[model samples]
Target: MTFRPISIFLSPNTEKDDVQLASKLLFKPWLWKKGKEILKFEEKFKKYLGARYAFSFNSGRSSLIAILEAMDIKKGDEVLLQGFTCNAAVNPILAKEAKPIFVDVDETINMNPEDLKTKITKNSKIVMIQHTFGWPAKIEEIKKITQESGLYLIEDCAHSLGAKYLPSQISKKLRRAKKLCGTFSDAAFFSFGRDKIISCVYGGMAVTNNKKIGENLKEFQKKMNYPSNFWIIQQLLHPVLMNYLILPFYNFLKLGRIFLALFLNLRLLSKSVVRIENRGELPSYFPQKLPNALTLLALNQFKKIERFNQHRQDIAKLYKENLEKRFILPFAREDKNREPIFMRYPLLVDDSDKILTKFKRRGIYLDDAWRKSPIVPPATDLKKIGYIQGSCCEAEKIAKHILNLPTHINISPNQAQKIIKLLLNAQ
Candidate 1:
């Protein structure tokens, strides 16, 4: 077999048309914002989620910032989120000057509603429920908890675009109709980063069904400015440069690795999380409007949402059927109506390091990239991010043993079989 790298960010969603468009738009960076593409993308996204309103931003963190601002999240107020997450999720709460109370996750790799109940206090204003790796959280139970506590609930759909949850008979208190992830909360935000279900290199969307929150979101969006032309150029160049300069040379003498580091160091490409964000400081440009150029790419991928998600579901099934009894796949089973997009298939193994090293040696680059710790970017200081170690024992234990396998559209069934076979052999 010819060796090829299988990684989510290695041009997984960037197709020929996307690259062609990005290349063409590179020279027209001056026309990057306030274009018809932005409005069209938002309208289509709203329709997709059956939401009353949608607003675009430069990143999912920016979208969350908009949601928090619109909700009037103020100083000393508490924002509760589960422990297994990224700084992208936590930094936004910090940006709003709110306290982030870490909640432990369950076997689903999502918020434990019981833990959520224990964490609530009079100061709590919102609960940010994440569909980690596209596994739907115990939303029905969690929603009921938030309702009883009178706390606003926001769905962090950054990892779960196109996923659905059908309420079970026991959850009849919730509307029994099937609901999309973003629709269940007061407001939800999605990421279109390079590795998300869809890619615009860097983009996000915020959606709300609440009329008052919708109006607030609209007003907040109006106050935000589009990113600068130079910044727009940086995003526009991402796919084109990576496809041309990075991936092709990546395994050849490690040239791609060197170029990636050089580009990030020289600021030719933007790091998904800036150094300061991991340090819990929000950058000035973190809360800007999504540029029209990037919105165009988002629209391109958004059109193929079903195709992308269907492929992911299929790959997840392969893992479920083939890797059974060999490894612990925590997020594999769901109720009939709950259709998860499965951005990455979560597996709990005895030694995460050993399995990851074995996969890497065989040309499969899957790793616990996002949730390496209770908070991500692994180097992030938990204290600075307000995570008290040992407070989330379940999350801390899962962090040490979790492995994520790629299930993006780029991985064909044949490639998925290879991954599954290798995983079984590893055990």
Candidate 2:
């Protein structure tokens, strides 16, 4: 029997078409940033998300930074956010010269409204709500608190592009309308990165119903330079690497782990990777515009979102039937309209180290990489990142115990069985 390693990413059948689309466009160098592609993609995306306006960025960090800037969040202002989230969500708060006040998360691995109410200070000007792993936070409750307190709400929809957080018990009349994650907040952002549900190597978008935020975002973008040709080429080369080398080749991942260890030990990737940026604090200035290459890649992937998301939903159902009760899992509330996208199926266990070791031995990928620290990638100071010690007890516990399985379209039935087998055997 072959040592089958279940990888989370499925090599897209559209990889050839993606490469072809990129090839035809590469000859038109002037079209790099000047083309209708970016604007067209933005228009389609805004309609898809039910947002009134959209602005593309080079990365999620850039989008969030722009949001803070647009909101005029300045020195001494506090931006309250969940402690148990990626550093990309927190770095922008630090970058804007404003202080980040860490809030705790509930079982959803998202912002806890109760904890949020307690953490708000007189200086608190914004609330950053993240739908971690596409598990919707108690949005209606959080929104009410932010509204009553006069705080701006910014949703981090990086992991939850298609997720719906239906109306909570606000009113029977309002409960019928289902709200997407990005639409519910004052402003929101999405990431199309290597591992995100909408993979395009690297790209992000800032969206808003607020005319002011939309206007400010366009103004800020006007001054930004387009990504260089070399950078574009690298993005163009992703399909081959992802589809051919990374997803199907178990040996590549095994060797990649060794390479990663060497890279970390030799300080290759950049020390502040844990913080989602190279420096613990963001630079005074960074590239903020979306590259044409990423946009082109994103456009190709955008067409297939429905099919892939449906597959992800199917995989989540299978996992629930097999792995429920044996592990702590995420689900929608009483509202039938609310459904998690299941970007990654999260489970809290006794010892992640032991489980990670067991899965590794079998070439089965359980996500140990998502939460090395509360800010992820291990060996980072929560204090430096603006999180106070002993403030988020639940987040801290969830961080240590949480692990996830990939629910991408590429995972087959046999691979899921192996994952279930491994998870059930846990002591």
Candidate 3:
């Protein structure tokens, strides 16, 4: 049984053009670390989202660290965040010597505003909301809660780039004004990791509309050094290496898998989640500036942002319109105001691991978008990461049942239909 692997990330997210760009940049060693590409990307990204200021970072987690530092988060200050998220989101709080208050998530796989209200304390200074899997959380309700409590709102827009939130009730002047997820909060951060809305191998940006906060964020950015040229080359080599060395032989006698392991072992390919991050510890390289090389790849992806998002939306619509009635869908298509740019269409199944195995055998790869834990990489110790068992019951349950289907730009309508048929049969 030989066929091309429909990977969740490796090949599906890598375009021919992306590989070409990386290949060209690999030879231009002078442009590898410092250049105007960084400034250009930041300018274009801020303008795209209507933000006043934007600062780039080494990763999404790095961006969060800068946000926390800029806001003066210190020992004992509580940062409220929901469960069913990556430790990448939580570790930044710990890095600042602040306490992380875990809030439960509603069906949107985002923070439950009701549960959020219960967790606020006098020490709680910030409320961080994750737009999980490109679905906007109940931002309007949460915004009101944060405002009444006098807590800063930070939107984790790692999974959501073009996703929007349309409120049901609005003033006549602002009626029907659907807002992008990152803009509604005091500050927001975006990821350009391999599996995100856009891929630059690894990168992030922190943006704010507030004059003072933006200035503070810039100061923090100025203090950090650019990533080493060696690190920059490693990131640039990712897509190029994957396309040529690994993806082609991935399923052929498991040769691709072997090549991938070999590269990772030889230190040529980088792992998205590093060893220290899973332990709720910050890496030495964090909070650094986003190098110029990766921005070339990111800026290229930015050009196709609309096309990428629309493709995901269309695939999500197809899934919503066709999946079996028994399957629990992520969003209500009937709510015209509640638009979700589905990074991956999530379904709650009886046994996620079992279903994933069946799909993998058929050359379709599926897995839980966030790992099967309150904090991702499931190996993370709950006590070490400030989560207790049964803390967020809904998120814990969802972690066991969540199965993500690919909705990236590479998936075709026909392929989606076939995937739907496979899912129905698997049931």
Which of the numbered candidates is closest to the native, going by highest TM-score? 3
Residue 105, candidate 1: how far off, in angstroms?
Answer: 0.8
Tens digit per residue, CA lDDT, model 3, 1-427: 4345776677456788989999999999888777899999999988889999999998998899999998989899999999998888989899999999999999878999999999998999999999899989889899999999999999999999999888767688987888888999999999999989998988999999989899999999999998877788789889988888787777788888888899889888888887887788987878899988888899889898899989998988888888848698866446667667888888888887777888878767766446588788777777898998898999998888788888998788888888888888887
Whole-model Cα lDDT per candidate?
A: 0.87, 0.75, 0.87
Flag regions of model 1 displaced more than 4 Å: 1-4, 168-177
Candidate 3: list runs displaced more than 4 Å: 1-3, 168-174
TM-score of each: 0.95, 0.89, 0.97
Per-model root-mean-square deviation over C-alphas: 2.1, 3.5, 1.5
Output candidate 2 Cα RMSD: 3.5
- What's the candidate order when arranged by decreasing TM-score? 3, 1, 2
- How would the candidate models be sorted by lDDT, starting from the highest? 3, 1, 2
* lDDT (Cα, 0-100) at 130 in candidate 1: 96
Clashes of each: 0, 1, 2
In candidate 3, residue 329 scores what lDDT?
80
Estimate, for each residue in 1-427, the C-alpha lDDT of model 1 and write its tens digit. Answer: 3324777557678777898999999878566887888889999998888889999999999999999998999999999999989988999899888999999999988999999989999999999999998888888899999899999999999999988898665365775667789988999999999889899988999999998899999999999998888788888888888888887777777788788889877888877777787789988888999988999999989888999999898998998998867888887665776778899888888887887788777656775466568788688889999999998999998888888888887788998888887878887
